[model samples]
Target: MKMKRKWTPSTRFMLIILYFEFIKETITVPCPASLHTANDVKRCPRNKLEWNARAARLNCSSINQTCVDPSLFEYHCVLNKEGNQLLEVCAPSKHIHEQKCTEFNSFGKLIQASVINCSDALITCPDAYRSTEMYKYQACYDVVYQSTRNEEAHCSSRSTEGKSHLGIAVGLNGEVKCCSGYKWSNRTRLCEKCTPGYTGPECAYSCIYPYYGEDCFKECDCQINLCDHQLGCTPVYWFNNCPHQPEYEEPAFTNTWKQRRDFR
Candidate 1:
């Protein structure tokens, strides 16, 4: 005789599959080419035949035409998974960009990283990437690279002394330079002060308390007497606070067993 098997509600629920639902519909959704209903767009030819065909067709590569995607590297894609194909995601089609990584903070930094296409996004780089900052300090920096997610984010170093947010320090000649004394902070997107003991504003300022003067690096001298920072330490003349005041002379005291007991 065959024994009848019973199915539990949990077991039955697990075996059931929802009908009419496309598993990949959410993930395989085709991303638009340029993010506009009808932005300047032309399907980039994926094959060698279509390589520069778009530019050639539009006559953008005629030297006289000012086309941004002459090489068709800045093109975007749309996909169709019905059978098999490529254009579902939107990103830079740059085929020849140097691979270099830079670190950024969660404060919305527009950092750059070496990407073999944009598939290798540096957004999740826990380490192995850092902006042109000397030290992470309080935080990294926030740089506004692209205005939208589809755009490329650029590295920027704004001086902590000036705009401490969403920008980097641009030298007088428009070059990236870390503000002196101010180490670049990845978290705050501003040049933050050095380690503890540093003075001046919040970031990169005079050295520390003990060390004063230029960059707060020069230390004061204590000399023979105890170093009373405010009183006689460095260049300031050594002046005793209690000069020749009354001298406390204790009278001779006789040790007694009764006095010892009383003191205790």
Candidate 2:
């Protein structure tokens, strides 16, 4: 005794659209933090499929690739689980070289004075004061082979006894502080010996047009604004065999001659 609802063409089309949307939501791939940035797609094959193919052809695999640029954190090529497509992964670098132990005080002391590896790791000591013998609680390790091995660095009063002129050192805040004579380099992670014509703590200052030597101490002897850092202004006459002209003279009337000939 109730009237049945009739299905219209428009209603059926809407139902089909909703069904596809549900399917898409259920089939999405997962992205990992170690592989992609927040703004990027949260799954493998972050780049265009074409680009990944090119990278794979170049043998850019994760096993052999390395990140050397200080600006970029890491990068490598990888393949999806299906092994039919390759993907390139990259991340930004971070300032994490100075790592503090979990249980140590700011002054580099243990909170509970527990045994090695029992309480907390020790502070990373200077390279000069690092222990030759291996220990379980040391916080230092060689720059290479960090994953497979870890070594401890022992600290001593001698660590603070270096001469300022001898070499660069790590400051109290773990920043690369230059010695008395050296300058800090913005292009590098440590203090550097600035080349000639550059100055300042950051070694970013350069000598102006006329100054050319270490610390801009030497001045160019050539024409103004024309002097070069390595080679100064060129000579007017470069040929050794070129004839020298006589000095000019004022023309004057002589007895029978028209005038005195000028020498040039």
RMSD of each: 25.7, 22.6
Q: What is the C-alpha local distance difference test score of each model? A: 0.31, 0.34
lDDT of 2 by residue, 91-149 (tens): 32221112221111112211111122212344442222111112222342212113212
Each prediction's TM-score against the native?
A: 0.19, 0.22
Query: Which is the leading candidate under TM-score?
Result: 2
As for model 1, its CA RMSD to the true structure in angstroms is: 25.7
Q: Candidate 2, overall lDDT?
A: 0.34
lDDT of 2 at 154: 17
